[model samples]
Target: MIVAVASGKGGTGKTTVSANLARVFDAEVQLLDCDVEEPNAHLFLKGAGIEEEEICIPVPEVDEVLCDGCGECGAFCRFHAIVSFGAKPLVFPDMCHGCGGCAKVCPRKAIRETGHRIGVVGKIRADRVTLIQGRLDVGAPMAPPLIRAVKARMRKEVPAILDAPPGTSCPVIATIGGADFVLLVTEPTPFGLNDLGIAVDMVRDLRIPFGVAVNRVGAGDDRVHAYCRDQGIPILLEIPEDRAIAESYSRGELIVDSLPRYRPLFEELARGLFDGGSPSGNRAGYRPFKSCQGRFRRRENGCALELHGKTCCGLDNRCGKPPCEDKR
Candidate 1:
C-alpha cells in the first residue's frame, strides 16, 4: 500500500503522521518525504547512515556563436524560459521545465541540453525502516522534478508512506498522484476544519480512498467533528491535544519511540488503512460524495457547488472566509 499523508495547509502534523506511521508499521515500510522544498523528516529520524545521490534536470544551453537571435525558440517555449530580443536569446534556467522545446526549435541548432542541479535524494535506514527524502536547492523554483526523483526509488517489495507538502497545489498533487490512499491530517480548530474541507475536495477529485486523522483534538470546538459527520467523511483516528507530544516533537524524537504508550494507536491506524486494498486496486477518482448526491457538479462547464447557501468551488472550500489566524 502506498499512502500519501497530506494537508491543505501547513503545520497540521503531516510529518508527524508520516514518521510515526513508519515507526509502527508492522510490515517492512519505506517513508518518502516528498516535501522536497522544506523536508524535515530527517530531523526526527536522525543519526542513520545515509546514501545520497544528486538529482539534476536538463536545461537549455545556447551556443551563442553559432546562432542567430531567431524568435522561434522563444515562441515554442510555452513557459517562456527563453526570450529573444531580435536575434539574441536569454535563458532563465530557473523557469525552465526541461521540455527541451527551445533546443528542438532552434533553427541554428545552437541550443544544447545541460545538466542543472536542482536537489539531492538521500536514503537512510533507522529501526529497520528506510527513510528516503529529497532536498531541493535553495532558491530553486522547481520541486516536482526532485519530488519525482525521490519517488522513483520507492521499494516495490514493501509498503510506502509519502509525506507530502501542504496546500492544494501542484507539489501536493505531484506527491499524491499515484497513492492508493491518502490520510488527510488536520487539527480540531477552525483553521483545521476549513483546510480539511479544501483537502477533502482535492482527494475526492482525485478519487483516492481517504480518511481524516484529527490531530490536536481538544484544541478547539467540535465543529470539525460536526463537519466530518455532516459530510460523511470517516474519522480514522484522533490524537488528543497533549503538551508532552509537543515537548517530544520539539526535541526531534519520534512519538512512538518517545511515548511508548502511543505505539498501539499508530499501529491501529496503519492496519486499518492498508487492509482496504492494494495500491493497484485503489484509485482516487472513483469515490462518491454528496452535495451533488454523486460526482462533482458542473454548471456552465465549470465546477461549482453550494454550501451554507453560498456557491463556491465544488470542493466546498469557504474561499471567501477571512484567513485563519494562528490560534495555537
Candidate 2:
C-alpha cells in the first residue's frame, strides 16, 4: 500500500513518522519526499550515494527573426505566459504551464518548444528505504512537474510512503493523489486541530481513506480527540511531548534510532492503519499525555474544551474550522 504522510501545517512531525515507519517495515520500501520546497527525509535516512536526474519543463521559444509578431500566440495562452506588444512577444518561462497552446496558435510558425530546468530528482538507498526527493531550482514557481518526476520512481511491488508537502494546497494534492491511504499528522493544539479539519475535508473530497496521527500530544489540548470523535476520523497514533525526542531531532537523529523501543510503536501504527484487524492493545484509544496541563487553555469558562494557539471558529478567519468548533 502506498501511504502518504501529510499535514495542514508545518512542523507536525510528518517526516518523522514517515521515516520511522519506512525503517520498521520488513519489505523493501520507497520513501518519496514530494515536498520539493523543503525536503528533510534524506537527513534521517542517510545514503551512500544518490542518483540524480535533472527535471525540465517545456517553454515556448519564439524565433523572432522568422516572423512578424502576431498577437495570435498571446491570445491562445491562458496563463498569460506569452504576451505580445507591437513587434515583440515576451515569454515568461516561470509562468508557462507548457501547454504548447502558443505554438499551435502561432500563425507564423515561429514558436518552438524549449526546455527550462526546474529541478532535479535524486534517488538514494538506505538499508530498507529507497529515498526519492525532488529539489526545485531556486526561483522556480512550479512544483507539480518536479513532484511528478519524484513519483515516477515509485515501485509498486513494495509498500511506499510519500512525504507530502504541508498544507492542503495543490502540492499536497499532487503528492497524495493516488495513494492507498493518507495519514494526516497534527499536533494536539488548536492550530493543529484547525488545520487537521481542513486536511480531513480535502482528503474526504478526494475520496481517499485517511487517519490522524497526533504529534506532541502533551504539548496541547484534547480538542483534537473531540474533533476526531465527532468526525469519525481514526486516531492512529499519539506521540507525547518528550524532551529526549526533541533533542534527538535537533541533532538530525531519527526517533526510532535514538530510542530503539519506539520502533515497535511505529510498527504497530503501520499495522493498525494498513492491516484489516482492529487497532492493537499497544495502539489503544486516544488519551492525552499527563504532562499536557495548561498547554490547552480553556477558551471560555464552563467549557471543558480548550483552545491552543489558534481556534478555528469557521468565521472570516481562514483556519478552515470544522462545523463543530464554533458550536462548542
Candidate 3:
C-alpha cells in the first residue's frame, strides 16, 4: 500500500505526520520524500549509509549537419522548447519537458535527445525506515521529472509513504498521482481550513481514497471539524498543540522517539490505513484506472472515465496497466 502524505499549504505538519508514521512501522515501511525542491523528511529519519545518484531529463538537441530547418520540430513542441523560422531550430534546454515529441515529429530526423541534469535521488537506510528523497538542482525549473525518478525507485514489496510537496500543484500531483491512499495533514486555523478544502477537492477529483489528519488540534476553533463533518471526510488522527512536540520538532526529533507514549496514535493510524482495511473499503489489489497514453482511463462495464486527458473509449488503446507511457 502506498500512502501519500500531502497538504494544501506548507508548514502544516505534513512531514511531522509522515516521519512519525514511518517510525512506528519500523522496518515495515519505506518513506519517500517526494518534495524534490525542499525535501526535509531525511532530517527526522537521520539514518546512515546515505547514497545518491544524479538524475537527468532528456532535452532535445539539434544536429545542425542534418537539419533542414523545416520548422516541424518547433511546431510539434508544445512547451516551445524548440523554435525555428527557416534555419536550424533553436533549442531551449530549460524550457523542454523532454517528451521527445520534437525528435519524433522532425521530418529529417535532425533532432536528438541529450541528458540535462536536474536533480539527485538519494537513499538512506535510517534505522528501520528506508529514506529515498530527491533534491532538485539549484535553479531547476521542473520537479515532476525528479519526483518521478524518486518514485521509480520505490520498493513495491513494502508499504511506502510518499511525503508530498505542499500545495495542490503539479509537483504535488506528480507525487500523489498513483498513491493507494492520501493522508492530508492540516492545522486548525482559518488558513489551514481554507487550504484543506482546496486540497480535499484536488484529491477527490483524482478519485483517490483519502482522510484528514488535523495537527495543532487545540490551537484554533472547530471549523475544521465542521468542514469534515459536512464533507463526510473522516478525521483519522489529531495531534494536540503541545509545546514539547514543537520543541522536539525544532531540534529535528521524532515525536514518537521523544514521547514514547504517543506511539500508539501512529500505530493506530497505521493499522487503520493498511492492516485492517483502507478507509475506502477497497484492498490493495484494487487499482481504479488503467493507463491510456498519458492519461488514466477507468473502465467500468462499458462506460469509461478518462482522467487527466480527453475522454475516449478503450477501443483505440491497448490498455494494460496504470501510468501509461506516452509513446507520442
Best by lDDT: 3
State which candidate, 1 or 2, has the greater TM-score: 1
TM-score of 2: 0.81
Indicate the worst ten consecutive residues by lDDT in candidate 3. Answer: 299-308
lDDT string for model 2 (170-260, tens) is: 8999999988778899998889989998999999999987778888766877788778766766556656677888998888888888987
lDDT (10s digit) by residue, model 3, range 1-328: 8889999978999899999988887446789999999999988989885789999899988899999888998888888889999998898887888899998998888888999999899999877689999999999888999999999999777778899999999999999999988999998899999999999999999999887888877678767866875676656667777798999999999999998766666766666566532322234422222112222233312221122232223223335433223311
Query: Global lDDT for candidate 1?
Result: 0.76
**TM-score to true structure, per model:** 0.82, 0.81, 0.83
Q: For residues 57-134, could you state the per-residue lDDT of candidate 1 as single tens digits?
A: 999888879878878989898888889878678889899888888888888899999999999999988875789999
Comparing 2 with 3 on lDDT, the higher-scoring candidate is: 3
Q: Worst lDDT window (10 residues) for model 1?
A: 299-308
Error of 2 at 272 (Å): 3.3
| lDDT of prediction 3 | 0.78
Rank by TM-score (best first) = 3, 1, 2
